[model samples]
Target chain A: MSDGRDVRACLGVCDDAADDPQHRCHPQHVGLRRVGARPGGDRTRGRAGRLLQASGRVVGGVSVSIDQRLVELGIELPTTPAPAGAYVPAVVSGNLVFTAGQLPFVGGVLPATGKVGEGDGLVDPAEAKAFAATAALNALAAIEAELGSLDRVTRVVKVNGFVASDPSFVGQPGVINGASEFLHDVFGEIGVHARAAVGVAVLPLDSPVEVELVVEFE
Target chain B: MSDGRDVRACLGVCDDAADDPQHRCHPQHVGLRRVGARPGGDRTRGRAGRLLQASGRVVGGVSVSIDQRLVELGIELPTTPAPAGAYVPAVVSGNLVFTAGQLPFVGGVLPATGKVGEGDGLVDPAEAKAFAATAALNALAAIEAELGSLDRVTRVVKVNGFVASDPSFVGQPGVINGASEFLHDVFGEIGVHARAAVGVAVLPLDSPVEVELVVEFE
Candidate 1:
């Protein structure tokens, strides 16, 4: 799965799919590529491998074009969240794009607020995890706004997640896993990334979670 | 000051200074390079340029080698603080180095604690500002530990600072400026970078300030 040649070839095909509209690799159209065309017949992961009909990574056979992957996962990216302060949503430096810390703002509103913990009057860790995932989606929205498409991303470099937690809570990593796991689901292998999660006293707008990303792009 | 040629030439000479100890851009030495060598004698800042004995950037003649600059500013970078968890202090990807969030620890101790705000039992804003600077210094120490020498840094890219706030604390930028200004003091023009400042509910170890850095190196 880490083979650079295979990854490059798959990405090259995805790029071609993007460039030529005639190619019907659009989202809502199944895995990135039809597994029927040239199935390598890889049997590494038992019957699951047989289900892979994605892209050029014949090894797993389940690498979909980024757009279609989102549709397949039933995740529609919301509008890129507006910045809350005097800064852009994301900044590009060299080959990397750094996203500003984003709160979980769904439909321009925080779904929940308050510190996260197990006690009463606090947001549940489970709910905060969902918010972390939503924040991650917002980060992708920011990246997509900057790059025009998420397909240009080559690697998800790092994720920094801040969870507003009660003094007795210390499950920051578990909470941030929502963001990390969502990235993995969308980008497949390339979405896997290094991460740091920490508990914070509070976040802007009283949101329970905030996430920022460092991604390498073409 | 933003001239590529001058910045490159200055950095190259700084590299040489690091390579050859006899060249002596050591902290004890006056200025990175004596303005006496080849003063372009630019009249931009008038007599202030008369003090321009540092490196090849004749524009302001004020750019000092990072080491000597710290010395001149009466600042000594403390030992690189140990990361409290299961991660490296800094990671290098391509030309960039991303440092883990750093807390303001001096001599292995948090000088003060508690959320920052304008009330009793809270960390004072001024003290929190210094803590941010100390945290920024720790970030530099971590960068130096990874790069072997700070002389190799070509640019300071992004900084993310987190301040533990007392709910009413709205001076995050002011507190984070301590880190930003310290970076400018050390790296001169290169230290000025894009930044994000946020007030968090709390931080690990109940630290008042935490700073992370993304820097570019040769």
Candidate 2:
């Protein structure tokens, strides 16, 4: 279900569908395209390949302390999100994880930054969408480091997005749509979540957008 | 320690300290200042006086649903924060309160909006610090709604900030100082918290800044 061409084509179709509020793709399709995990897919039971086919490469670059028990569950940590300002990176209280805002940074440079409807300023929409998705990936990486595996994630409860936009921009939802859809694509039904799409006057580093995620532990 | 003039002077000093990178008052202070309550001195706990001070008229033109538990504990709820964009006001989960980005909207219109560190966008150091403090008040209001009382707040936890800024600006820590110091003043040691401050290219409605609070419930 996740051929490269198939994912790209699905992205294209979803972009079009996003423009029409009435057109909502089922949550399963998004799960395949984003995180690459199929709903009800199980790993650690020697079905690792199936889980991999359903998601992207979560190889390395992650550094943080996660629970020892979670590590034993076959969860691979992703890279920690870099701080973009004077604030700390993440905070933990009990079983919940609250991450600071994350930008879509590749090699410490914003490939795209700008309003989605106004054309990417520092980064464009497609790229920003990718960046937002990547930011979500980074968030997962952080979660993995803290909890030991993406498996401990009960659900992606809420996502708050801040998109840098032009004054006249009205497609805030569309821009954040990329991230939202990607989340579902990754976590499947567990990935489905409640969210807020906000158009801000600007974002940190003039990046097109910034994202923050809240996840529950199993 | 609660000398009227001394407390006022200390507030003045902290208010101007926004750009100082040192100490800035936070929510507890804002709450205390509202009631002329200061440490090591007047322990004014009169019911009528407390209500008059905490819930003065109405704010932001939005009513919040204060938790009955908080009410039983004698905590007053602040007004709901006005949405900066096309998003719901706030969300609650279990014993936590997550407030959407709150702006410095007083009556209805923003008293100030623009980039900081550029010819005083919202009030150089003192005013900007006060603005952040005011925003904290709004966040407290949101928290009260979820937990019913400020006392239910086991800890202030974390605050994430986004400041609209001029391209050449770099005064994030200074601006966030206001909120931090204010919270400390209001909740005493419980108000002390972790925070993040980032300079954004812009914010919704061209508002100078946006703030969100993560509070733990008792």
Q: For residues A1-218, could you state the per-residue lDDT of candidate 1 as single tens digits? A: 34433433343244334212245543322112111101232213322331232222223445456777666556778777754432235666788888877878877878887888889989998678778888999899878876888888888999999888787987787678678656755775567577888887766656788899999999
TM-score of the second chain in candidate 2: 0.64
* lDDT per residue (tens digit) for residues A55-144 in model 2: 322313332223332243233334564443223344456576776667665545566655555443444555556667666656676566
lDDT of 1 by residue, B4-85 (tens): 2333333323322311212323111211221110023222332233123223222354545677755555566668899989
Predicted model with the maximum DockQ: 2
TM-score for chain B considered on its own, for each of the candidates: 0.73, 0.64
Q: What residue runs in model 2 are displaced by over 4 Å at the alpha carbon?
A: A1-32, A35-79, A85-87, A93-95, A107-122, A168-174, A181-186, B1-93, B97-117, B120-126, B141-152, B157-174, B181-212
Best by TM-score: 1
**C-alpha-based local distance difference test score of model 1:** 0.66
lDDT of 1 at A82: 53
